[model samples]
Target: MDIKAYIESGIIESYVLGLATPQEADELQRLSQTYPEIAAAVAGGEQWLRETADHYALPAPEELKTQLLARLEHEFQPEKQAPDLRYYRRDLFKYAAAVLLLLLTVSGLLNVYLYNNYRNASRDFVRLQSGIDMMAADNKAFQAKLAVLEQDLRFITAPGTIKVPLAGVSGREDYFATLYWNTQTKNVYLTANHLPAPAPGKQYQLWAIVDGKPVSAGLLNPNCTDLCMVTPVQQAQAFAITLEKTGGNPTPTSDQMVVLGKVKA
Candidate 1:
């Protein structure tokens, strides 16, 4: 029932080339009637075979026509008293020309069918290959994303990690964020749990307060929604995030502060 698999199996090619067994041929005929794809595949195969045959077709021998005419004249030679055989000979030639014309007409029709089939098959192959390539690219991307998530999971579950919950400041009560810091390794990671996306040409920057002074940590990547590693700090009394231009400023813009959190003693 898998039409694509069946087409790729080369059974259609075998059937078109007159190489299929009786049972196989019967099955192909039945399937062709039942499925449009199967029918089209069969037509493509037939076209390919015909084109191949034409490409290798041998030219008729030059002496062949002379031999045929001589043999015909001898076979129809008139008796000694009878009139010359010219009239009968003319009729025979006419009949021969008619037969030759019929054969040429049939050959031309076959050529046309084969050419059309070849074009259709080529188009189908291009489309199928494109689809396969796209699927492969998507699969690779998914695997890469899964690997990153797995790494984040391991880091989150490690011991000696402190989780700082950041709450939205002022009117932005709905926004929130989280920061995970590993005290032993001096590593920090941030996640924008419920923060709204920054406006165009702006980004969110993290600041670590040390000895009552704000220290620039790093800028948060706008595209990252999950845990992302940030600048490490050995000590901090508080953490805050503020909106700034694309590249963050040396000092935090206090009015643009979105979320603020303090580290527990």
Candidate 2:
């Protein structure tokens, strides 16, 4: 319905005069609840009527106020009321317990969360520190290796250093050796990895085999895993390894020709 047409009608004036039909009162209640504008208009009209009645106030006498209060007390006086001290105390205890339980649950959750996070953080920190220490150790090891390589290069390149080539032995498929000889200082670096280890109680005697005769230059033991031996060859031509008795034999054992290498001319 168009509220403008309803407002212009004389039903609101008739309702104020207490002459509206029951159907009109119900419709007005519904309109008041449905539309704030209609509610506001009705409230303003009622307020105006109240203000007009106030301006023409025939005030209530003091006797009327006392009589109205007496009538209210007579209408609502209770027949029986219990003293509820214990019951009220029990209710208060229940509410307090509920509040304490809630607080404890919240506190326990927070503590568990904090403990787990603290433990995880501690583990992470330890792992990071360990990684840092391992990196430092690896860096130091690499630096030491670099120093050893530099020293080796310098020692090999020194002046008057003899580089003697020891050729491969015939009939042994992969037998070869080289001697980095430093003749000026009588120091030789034997690269003897291709040679085989001699039998027990029999060592490899390094011989300077010149003109079909074996000269005992020096004896090279078979412990070449960590280091190479440094023995000078005073009169070297062809190299030969012979199996000799314990310590070493003065002459080469003819039957045990384990390795032989001719000197490169």
Candidate 3:
């Protein structure tokens, strides 16, 4: 396999971001074990992400350590009986080391996942914050928008949500996106996760093939959040996105199709 091409496909980003499905994750893990280049890429990505997050890390409160130690002391206290000093000391050190190691491992893993989520949320917040600050925004309006996003997240993470990876077409190998389709609800949501900003007066449009005809799913807004709701279809055999004139076209211009993916059976 082409290691460089695999790395450039954005699967690594999706995996690091916790967006890849179980199958995809399993495949990546297998590849990482089989290929030195993949293993290096994954490790490098994790290290770079950790270093980037360190700049934004906040210092813990002074009292926090004291409280943690106090709790640990209480938990490891001897029962209502005389204790062996040397044995107690040895066990105490062992347990303490184990606890510390566990905490560090969990914290590192949590930080990676949380950092990706925080980055996405921060982008959305920054985009709207300026307008909110200028308008002295209505709390209800803000909450409503937030509620919608929370709902979308629930749908995306819900069990049975099918993740379809869309790859860039000819001449646009770097462009990619994902489709989260809920079979039960027949709801389709599109995320322009890695696609570059379209040129002026051009926009990306999504299409779903149903009954041998192409149906416009929706026109993607470049400025929209990572997840955007597209028109729901009862059924689709495939999905494709194309760059079209602003406001989109009645039908996709074949020559302009940027990415496409077939729906799994």
Judged by TM-score relative to the true structure, which candidate is superior, 2 or 3? 2
Error of 2 at 250 (Å): 3.2
Summarize candidate 2's per-residue lDDT along 118-162 as a digit string, tens digits.
999999999999999999999999999788667656657877555
Highest lDDT, which number?
Answer: 1
The alpha-carbon lDDT assigned to residue 128 of candidate 2 equals 99
**TM-scores of the models, in the order given:** 0.60, 0.52, 0.44
**Native-to-model Cα distance after best TM-score fit, residue 234 in candidate 3, in Å:** 1.7
Per-residue lDDT of 1-265 in model 3, one digit per residue for the tens? Answer: 7889998898887888789999999999999999999998888777766886797899999999999998898577566544577779989999999999999999999999999999999999998888777666667777888998899889988976888889998898888999999988888888887887889999999999887688998889777866888878778888999999999999989999888888898
- lDDT of every model, 2 decimals: 0.91, 0.71, 0.87
Predicted candidate 1 versus true structure: per-residue lDDT over 215-248, tens digit per residue: 9889998877789899998899999999999999
Q: Which candidate order results from sorting by lDDT in descending order?
A: 1, 3, 2
After superposing candidate 1, which stretches have Cα over 4 Å from the reference? Answer: 1-84, 199-202, 211-213, 223-225
* Candidate 1 lDDT score relative to the true structure: 0.91
Clash number by candidate, in order: 0, 0, 0
Lowest-sum lDDT 10-residue window in model 2: 221-230
Please give the TM-score that candidate 3 achieves against the real structure: 0.44
